[model samples]
Target: MLFDLPDDAVLYTALLARDAAWEGRAYVGVTSTGVFCRMTCPARKPKRENCRFHETVAGCLEAGFRPCRRCHPLACGSGAEPSVAPLVAALEADPARRWSEDDVVARGFDPSTVRRAFKRQFGITFLEMARLRRLRESAGVLAKGGKVIEAQLDAGYDSPAAFRAAFAKLLGQAPAKFAEDALLRADWIDTPLGAMVAVSDRSALHLLEFSDRPALPSSLRHLLKASKGSLGLGRYAPTDQVEAELGAFFAGQNATFRTPLALEGSEFTRTVWQALVAIPAGETRAYADIAREIGRPSAVRAVARANGANRIALVVPCHRVIGSDGALTGYGGGLWRKRNLIELERGYARA
Candidate 1:
């Protein structure tokens, strides 16, 4: 179920109190400074009229507020883990460096401890985070027509085979396989929550999923096969269009997705996805409710399957589905993200 925040007056009171209970669940965007902070931020409180309360970091960012440096509101989880903070700082300092376990040991931190801390807070190990960043940089180079070897060296990879393997593991296609004139092109879109990979043809978006999703490689493989190996690393018109739409969406400026979508699935699955699209941004539906909506009351299980199969994330609104008891059900983007998405959309409801 979506977590409903207290009314503005109550939130204002909490903000004044420096409430820790609302640490991860609520944020305050100051209109005067255009900065957002956690409720527990030690900075002096803003005037009541200057404060804008948001349920998620995405909401704050959508409203044109930058994270407060003092509070570090963008840190993972409730706050940055002490063990993970320095490592994140180092990664930011040198994102192109190929980090290894030996480097972690040389820095006097146990690799396992660092791994566990990052996983506990971010759902990804610090090394995985660094690797993803490097790969994203390399992908950008390729998108701009750089050579594969240049990209490999720039990403801090010494071996061509190693670079290809890592690239394929994340994108399901070797760097060399991306054709310049492919019909379906893929690109990365950065959002407040995380980075997303978008695949599109000239006129329609085909898939949009968080890059860190466990199923991303398989989804890309399927897309490659379906497109007859015409998938490449670059943006198409629809990719640019969807990227802008996503920016507007996360900024809370607009909830509507104007980009054309190519829904690839069976008739029933397409029907279920259409039903999901019908659900308003701030509302949720149960699997059985969706089944009944599609005139297949006994197909609740199938409806759940279709929800899981949705690849387009926020634009399809699959995260709005909840359990029959109003519990947050399984979401491909992870339950934490589902909760944030639901919370962020409540702003849309109110607007």
Candidate 2:
């Protein structure tokens, strides 16, 4: 739906008019000010060329745009301030509100100071956090077998078409066609590395990957097909367990993940995955080393494929693998995250 949006001049016109029809449909990220706002925002309009319209707050945040203060572009309907737990609760209750910095100021808080504090504490601005909350709410609704309409409405999209487009943009699938009756539940976990999506059931963790991983859509498709459409969005026991363990792991309290994992892979791939798990938290391994460990010394490519196929990210430790040349190779989560993980682990190892 983002691509279907009107031309820049038309969109800028809508923003200038503060069109309520465009509410929940278009967000404008101003290049000059590095701020994004809903079309309905009451703030002074920026120049036409300064505006970059996005379909979702996530896009704005990813593009480095802070939420507008006057219009409260990130505010849930509750108008909660970012300084308290009420803000999170408000987001959970209605994640789609365009919260603005003025909402914070209305609650006797300083917008710039709150932004700085939130970034320091959460490693992301309040708008990004609210965006994630909205996404999680939609995912949870869908996971519970709610209709596409329900999920769309809950996600704050007034237009079905716009909602479908946003859903597709985020999850790479049309909402109506998304799988249901999932044997595994999908939930989001936040970390300094951004947001990670984890799918699991009561017993074992099935899949975990950074939300931005390119392979995420295909992986979800494969899992849904393999499990016969039994992958919905919600939390399972394994999800809770992994979230806690991951927090500790990232905090350097412990690197061990004892969460049970239900790996779905070929025998060889499973072997490779097991080898990856065997890699110590503060250590690195090479593809050839993994192949050798799996008794497939000549299957370097296959081993690499197996490693790439791993569904559980941190728990499986795929980031621990490096190229034989000592270069950080491909990681589904991104090489930057891999590098950080390695650095974090190595530091912990020394400590």
Candidate 3:
């Protein structure tokens, strides 16, 4: 789900008032200065015509505007939660360290408080974030033909069983289970937002999701079952195509994705996906709107369920769906990413 911003006139008024309500939801890019700032920035305001409002920092950057030095608009989302900032910094400082609840307590912070803060801001606990980072590193080593023991050490896991459990939690299988030659392959694709895991066969992409998504393990399990355990580590033709298209999309070069997709769902779900693709990049549709468009005007909830069940991420454009009230609802990729995607597409509309 994405935040629907008000018209420019109303947004300008909010900017003039330095409204705190719009601090993270809306930003104004100053055309004259070539910079973007949060609504609560204390710097002098620009004239109405010279101001351009966007819903995300990615939008500002795509439009060729640098972050304002005074406001530091980029930090408003990640650093706004005071309790989460220091922990994020520490994680960045030593990403490979095996973090634990005891370590948080030793840092003079309550473990529960830290957990809640991280969950509220990033949609994951601090320890979960650390574990995901370590696992991703380990996955990289395995992808490059490294041994399981080497990968475990690289991820900073002292116990083999602990490492296997953690890896299985994220991937739904142990590192050793992946075959050297398989029909369907999985690979990592880095994007502007984060790293995404892409699973594909020779002709079509089966799955594309953020590596840290909680639902990833279940999704992988389902995919493996469907593929009859013919899943391994490597890219297929579809993976390469999607990687390029995603790169272009984030770079603001092209919004269209032509990669072939192997959609695995019921007829109704597939219909919903078609309706989603018909939506223009810069616009959004509510569940009711999608239902009506799909010729099932009363199936709003069903449409929402199908949207959630979608496996291929941006290529299917599930992020283009929002609540009926224009509020961003639940997005599997995280609300922060949903906002960025919605705002980033506005550049496509302008182009």
Candidate 4:
């Protein structure tokens, strides 16, 4: 409603007026400079045909445009210090020790800013986030190496009880409960989009869902029972591979997911999910069409339910499923993200 128009149209008008309100939502790429600028960029405007709009920095990069040094498209302003991306890296390397305000000052950062940044972005304070990150690492250790006590120490917990409680809180299982022989092994993989959790057995990936999917816990609970397996943090075949391929996918380079997955669902559910995968990138499908594709034309309601049950997001491609009237439906990640996903995919769109 800012300009009483659709996003693209509003963006076009904003571009025409060089509006400041539309800064983050839109970017303009000039083919001449081979660079992309923020909506508020003061650079001389090029011809409308020469100025292509993008939804994100990733989109501009994918389109082979470098970020303009003047615009600094990748920068974000949370309460975090202007120089704190490396803190995440440092915490990844050593998360056990109590990181004090003095320690943060030593790193040339305001500790409060650090705390706020972590909280704003991750919804958790820096110390709590470090604890969680370390705990996740410990879960991986127990899942694969068959060691519990070692995992506890590796997670930076001095007391085993503390580690066990944290593990139980995050994953329903204690570290000691992690089994190597279960039908499924849950693990974490980082992609360009974000961190994802993949559950797999020796043969196939039964569950490949993003860590942030609101339906993840429910999906895992259902899938775990179905697979006769326990869930914990760990990694397996194709999780790493999928992570790499997804990075490429997000960069708009190519869709190169070759990981074989163990699809889990009822016969009808399986059909709906398979059809979901068949949906090409940058395109969308109606719920009724999905039902029709499964040969259950009247099962649109059932198909939509199955779509909600889908574990994988971008991979299994549930984001492509829309309403019968082509409206975005209730996505677990929120409809705005669904819209962003569609636009991200359409960046490389071809006729």
Top of the candidates by TM-score: 1
lDDT of 1 by residue, 1-351 (tens): 223666668989999999898988888888667678999999999998677677766555444455677887757373456667777667656767899999888888999988887777655677876676577668768988999998998788879998999999889979999878998998877665666889999899999998778999999999999988998888889988887787677666788998899999999999999999999888999999999999999999999998999988888999999999999988888898888898888889998
Question: Candidates' TM-scores?
Answer: 0.75, 0.62, 0.70, 0.62
Per-residue lDDT tens digits for candidate 2, residues 1-351, read 234565567878898898888886778887667667889887888987466676665556554455676776655232333474455445545557646677667767777877776565434576657655556557667766788888777777668887787676666567776545557667666554556788887899888888878888888777777777666667889898998898677556788899999988778788788888888878898999988888878999998888888878999999998999999998888886788788778756797
- Candidate 4 positional error at 216, Å: 3.0
Cα lDDT for residue 135, candidate 4:
55
lDDT tens digits by residue: candidate 4, 77-133: 322545456675566456565455777788888888888776555445666555544
Write model 3 residue lDDT over 124-170, tens digit each, in one string: 68897777657766887888788889999988897888888988887
TM-score of predicted structure 3: 0.70
Is 2 or 3 the stronger prediction by lDDT? 3
Q: What value of lDDT does candidate 4 attain over all alpha carbons?
A: 0.66
- Candidate 4 weakest ten by summed lDDT: 1-10
Clash totals, every prediction: 1, 15, 0, 2
- Stretches of model 3 off by over 4 angstroms after superposition: 1-95, 104-129
**Which of the two candidates, 1 or 2, achieves a greater TM-score against the reference?**
1
Q: For each candidate, what is the lDDT?
A: 0.82, 0.73, 0.82, 0.66
Alpha carbon lDDT of residue 317, candidate 4?
A: 87
Superposition TM-score, candidate 1 onto the true structure? 0.75
